[model samples]
Each structure stands twice: as C-alpha cells, then as structure tokens.
Target: MHKEITIFNETILPGESKTIHMQIAKLHTMTDLQIPIIVERSKLDGPTVLFSAGLHGDEINGTEIVRQLIVQKINKPKRGTIICMPIINIFGFVNQTREFPDGRDLNRVFPGSKTGSLASRFAHYILQEIIPHVDYAIDFHAGGAQRFNAPQIRIVPNNQELKKLSDVFGAPFTLYSNHISGSFRTSCDHMGTKMLLFEGGKSLDMNQKVTDEAIEGSKRFLKHLKMLATKHQSMEAHATIYITKSDWIRANFSGMFHGLKAIGTFVKKGELLATISDPFGKIEHKVKAPHDGYLINVNDAPIVYQGDAIFHISKELE
Candidate 1:
C-alpha cells in the first residue's frame, strides 16, 4: 500500500478521497476565496497524476473537461492518485478575464516568489505544495481571445518520453514547442514532472467536441500509466500528427471579416481562405493561403485589423 499523502496540512490516507480548500487571500468584500483541490488516491501504489485547468480564468473549456472527469468518476484511479484543480485562477474566472486582479498573466509567472504579487504568490504556493508529488500531469488550455484552436497537444521537442505519452494520448495534432520562461510547463519540467499541454476551443466559450477530445485523450493517458479504473474502457485513438513548424496568417486589410475555411482542414497554395471587406460594401480583400498546410487556429471574431493573426497553419510536419 502507498503511504499517506499530505496537502495543505491535511493528511489523506491511502484509498481515501478528500477535497482540500486552499485559501490564499480574501476578496475585497472581506469574504474568503477558497480554491478547491480534489484528490483521489487508490490503496495500491502507483503514479500520481494531476489534471489542472483554468490557468487563464476565461478558458472555460479546459475547466469543463476537468469537471467532466470528476462527474464521470474518471478521476477515481485504479492504483494511483488523481488530483483535479478545475480553476487555478479563480479571481480571473470570477471576472471573466485572462489575468489576475493585478492584470498579470498567471501563465507568465511560475516558480514564483512568496513575497511577490498575488498571482506570483499563488504560483509559488502551487509549485511548492502540489507539484512535488506529481509524476505526470496534463494541463488544459484554450486559445486566447477569439481564436478557435483545433484540439491539440503541445510538448517540447526531442523528449522521447513525452513523445511516447503523446502517442498514447492521441490528440488529433501534437505541436513541438519550446519551453517558455516562467511558464508552468517549464517549471514542471524543471521539477522532473512530465506534462502535456492540451489546447483547444477558445477562451470564455465551451465546445462539446473539444471537451470530448480532451477527455478521451486523458483516459488514454491514465490507462497508459495503469491508473484508469476498470469501469472506463479507454477508446482507440488515431495517430496524432506531429507539427514541427507553424506560422500565423495575418490579415492584410482592416474590415469586417468573413472566414471561408474550417479549422483542421488543409488548403492549397494561394487558395482563398477568407475575405475582408469594408463595412460600407466597397473594396474587398482576399486572404489566401501562403502555402499548402493544415489550418489549426481560426479567428472567430467578426472584425479584423490589418496584421491581426487570422489563421495558424502548420508549415512543417513529422
């Protein structure tokens, strides 16, 4: 049997389930704001997996995925521990914004200082308290703003272990990315935790398809670690396309935007992808594909400004 685990000064025995309320700071109204951390541990010894979301408060799709995992009892592991933190940035989530009350992006602050900004202190708390016990983690995210991203997994290139895990999870697309300084993924990596960053849908919106993809992939990931419960049968997954290089397609004109191409579809060179026209119905401009590639991100906004990114296409694939 595995030994007992402690979080936030509360000890959880093997095979026990507990919800720890992490109270960092109070709201302006003098009310306590608690971040609920749900933990489930199996009596048998195994890996500890963390499924976290809502790092950006507006990215509700990720939060929905984690919530479904809990509702469906998928977080009840067969021989390991499962921890779910559905809303990391509860402050931003309440305000429907992407940043903290201080306007600092939580994603940009990692392994933070105890005596720093509110966001930084929270970051420090997470790394110090939760990350040490995590063996593998899947952090969910969605596109920032109005850009709709096709369901995808992102990992740093040249990591064979992560690449193998990505193959097991089987996201439709897996992109190679470098570690961003002060990002949670980077900090996790430094702490020797393997993590897969899942991105899909868009901020402040929820898509059923995106949620389904993330949940399926998560099940596959758990199964690979021999931690999935017997009741849930892991589904067969398609081979994920590995993207080595990509670039954003920017709008050439400022106007009311009309996109013609769907996300996750390939387009030929110079093919018409979208149209930008003046609101007055004069002087329309066509946005075409720079080359043949798969469109992974499509802007959903009705309006576009010149040089605004409208599409993100894979330029090189593996």
Candidate 2:
C-alpha cells in the first residue's frame, strides 16, 4: 500500500511532488551545501521506488538519466512514490571528483555516523532520511576513471524477485556481486530494502548509448512495477545472461595498452583482448582471455602501470 513518504524532515502526501533541500554539511568557508531530493507520489497505493545516482560524483550517466526524467516529466508515479536523488555527493560533483573532497569514496562509508567525515555524515543522513521510506531502489553507477563498463546490473544472487526485475530492466548481462563494506547496497540490504545497482558508460562524460539504455530500462522497470499508467515501448527481446564469476585482466607490464575490443564484445578463451607495449613500442606484452566471456570493462587510458586491471571478464551462461 502507498503511504506518506517523508524526507529531509518534510512530509510528502499522496499525489504531490516536492523538492526537499537537505543541508548536509558546511564547507570550509562556512557555506552550506545541500542534497536536493525530488519526491513524486501518486494518487493510488503502490510501492515506493527510489532511483539514485552520483554516489561517485564523476559518473554522469545516471545523473543525466534523472535529468531527462525530470525534463520529460515521464516519472508520473500512478500508485507509489518515486524518489530521485541525482547527485548525492555534491562536494565531489562540484569538484568533478569521484570521492568526497576529503578523498574518501562516498559509496564506501554507508550507514555512516553524524560525527564522521564529510562523506560519512552525508551518507548517514541520506541513509536515514530517504532509504527507510523507499520500498525499492536502483543506484546507478559506472566504471571508475580511465575505465568503461558495459551496461549491466549487479544484484545479490538467489533473490528471484530481484532477478526478475533485473531481467525486465533488459540489460545484456547481470553480475552477482558481493556486498562490500559500508557500501550503499550493503546498507540498504541491512535495512531489508530491495535494490539494484546499474553500471554503464564511463566516468566524467555521458555516453549516449548507455544513457539511452538507462532511460529505456528504467521506464521498463517502472512499467513492470505498475507505476506507469500506460505501457512503455516494447524493447527488443534479447537473451540476458548472468555473469556469475568474473576477474580482471591486469596489465602484465608497465606500458601503453591497446584494447582489442570494447564493451559488449564476447571474447573466447585465450583470445587477444589487449596488448601492452613500452613507450618505445619495441616490446609488447599480450593480455589474453583465460575464459570465454563478454568484456565488461576496459581501461581507457593508454598508459597503464603493471598489474592494473585494464580488462574484466566474467563467465556467463547463454
């Protein structure tokens, strides 16, 4: 049943849309920074779904996806609430950095404390304020700096409902990732919240393909949740595989890396995925696949240090 949702000490009634400005912390110059949340509730009873992005401030695909939702006004929740927090790390977002200004990853300090660092304090506040009111959540993510991730969903394994949503979201692949310490997924899981983490594109710049997929997949998900009053466009039916086990292909030598394939390409076992060569280009080292799987991520930067995870592969079932 749909219920009254509250965030940042403000109550949003049914069939209402409110932007709650949450002041998380004071800057070094004593200026206040706020996390703006957009809450849209429906006239009928349904599940409250939360869509968040920019936990790593540099990932702009999710931020752009939310912006488009607001621009198009497509998020008319017919029965439940839709909470949109596009940019969570305002400090890092403004600074064009992934972590907080204090150099701690915002995603690593979830279920945090009030007296902790800037990131932790913000995490604690948002986790306490917004997550409790949410019945389902989808946190958007992407590859770290100098890397790119194929569009995929990372879910906690053995959860059928979550698995069905992951499939309905229509990503080509799904990853069964473990919960990391202090992560947002971990915190939500502890609170018994069902959530999915979508990773696509790369850091900084927003790729059009990834962004389009995100928007389409999100609309499909909302439709599946019965939030939308009408049916969404029919996305092409494609087999979605689960990449249960994955590993990163580290650079064998300190040199320039030349990728053989981009995201979404399936490589065979022992296939040449990339080549690492010295600056002079006289000597080279090959980075090949140890198993047949789709390439999820590849280092974008040319120069890589030894043992850098430039390529990622996961074993999948067709």
Candidate 3:
C-alpha cells in the first residue's frame, strides 16, 4: 500500500478515515453538487472493498444500509480500505427517481463519457476515481416500482471471488444472472474488480428485517475477508440457496392483481400464485406457477396490466 493514494485529486493516507466531499457537477441553481465519500483505510494493507448504493435514487434500501454502516461505525476495516458511497445519485435521490434528471438510468451508462447525460457524467466520474482502486465491491438494490424482492444476492457467473463473497454474505438466496454491458458491475469487471449486487425489499421504503440481514451479511463478509474481528459466534446452518434459473409469472390479462403468495413461499407446478381480476370482479385470470420452486418476489402493486410481472419463481434446485 502506498503512503498516499490520490482520489479526485485529494490524497488519502493509510490509517486514516474521513468523508471526502467530492464536487462532481453543479446544479441548475449553480450549487456545487458533491458526492459524499467515506473512506476508511486500515493500518495494515489488504483488499479494498467498496460499498456503494443508490445508483438508482429510488432504490433506497441500499442507501439506508450504507447509512447504518456509517452511523454505527460497523465498517472497521482492520486490514484494508473501505470506500462507502451511500448515495451516489443525489440528484435522482432528491427527486425520488430511478434515473437521472434527464431520465437516463445511471446504472445503464457506466464507464460513461465526460461529455454525456447527467447519469453518464456521474458514471464517468465514478469510473475515473473509484473503480480503479477497488478490489471487491457490492452494490445494494431493491425491487423497482410496485415490486418487493426477497433478500438475495445477485451475481454474474465465473467470478469466484464474488461467488465466495456472496456465499459468505449469506443472503437467503443467490441469483446468478448474465452481466449487462455498460453497467457499473460490468465497468468494474473491466477493471478486474469483483462486484456483486444485493437485492431486497422495495423502492422508496425501509424494511428493518432486510436491513438487518444486509448488515449482518456485510459483517460476516468482513470477518471472512479477515478485515474485521469475528464478533459473531459460529453462524447458523442455513441452506443459503443458489438459484440458477428464475421466471416471472406475468399477468395474462390486464386487471387487478391479487397475490396468493408472498416472499419465501414455495409453490408447486401449476399452482395458483395469483389471480388477476377486472375491477368489477366479473372475470378472473389465474396466474399459475410454471414449475415447482421458491417464490422469491411478488408484485406489491394491486393493479396490473397484461404482461406485467406478478410473481418471481426461482426454479427448484434438484
């Protein structure tokens, strides 16, 4: 580890921890838009992990998780650096949106160009300043509008380090998905940084249970990485499922959705997961499971349109 590492032109030394008020852009009112960064470096050198959330401003569970870590001082990196960016998309966060002010999804325009949309500019800054120095990372997320995803870890295949971290994080389930081009994870991938996404709860709200699990999993990860002391005794023996395939049971007809199951429910093949009915209840469209599996997520919204995702079922592991 170098005595001093420069980030955003500000030099940070080992055995130091502070909030870096990095100015990334300016608001319309000429206010200085800043990205608040909390960097904690250990006295001894080890892996550098970044815990970032709120890439999509509306996804606030991640923001709350990072805030909890900071306020409680849970991130005691004994052997490495921890860069915590609780809210990267302050603009979108302020507006309670999933995209930038211009409606571009920040996450979909990663490793962005200096001269691009608000989302792209932010992404560009992050890539230029953050990803190069990170070894491992986790971006917290939650279900989008009108959706509630169960607490889970989402990752790409073939990343052993990410897989190990996901296992140690110990989310109730791990979902394997393909990498998206121009995503923050993909950008970090290009930089040889292993990053995983943690999904839970829903947007624009707080769930204490999910938050607790996220914090616990993060602590467990630190312990496994030898970056923090093990305050926990032996962990419980939970199966911690690895789901390889998942399908969304969408509505066959536009109507009101009545979910028959919630997160953590197991359904049998052809089981009725939900019922879609007209406002008058004149006609009902049954939404059934295609296969036996664990129901990981369910639509929180009562109203639905044809083709809307209502139930998310992960194929049963044989």
The local distance difference test score of each candidate is: 0.95, 0.85, 0.85
Candidate 1: the clashing residue pairs are: none
Best by lDDT: 1
The digit string of per-residue lDDT tens for model 2 on 1-318 reads: 546776766889998999999887777899988888998888888998888999998988879978877676666676788888899988878888898988999889988899998889988988788888888898999899888999899998888998898988888788998899989999998987899899998889898888788787888888888886563453653557788888898887998888889788988999988888988858988888999988888789888998888988887663
Alpha-carbon lDDT of model 1: 0.95
Candidate 3 per-residue C-alpha lDDT over 32-91 given as tens digits, one digit per residue, 9 for 90 to 100? 878798999888988888999999999999999999887777665878888899999999
| lDDT score of residue 116 within candidate 2 | 96
Give the number of the best model, judged by TM-score. 1
TM-score against truth, every candidate = 0.99, 0.95, 0.95
Q: What is the C-alpha lDDT profile of model 1 across 155-266, one tens digit per residue? A: 9999999999999999999999999998999999999999999999999999999999999999999999999999998889999999999999999889999999999999
Worst 10 residues of 2 by lDDT: 229-238
Q: Quick one: how many clashes does candidate 3 have?
A: 0
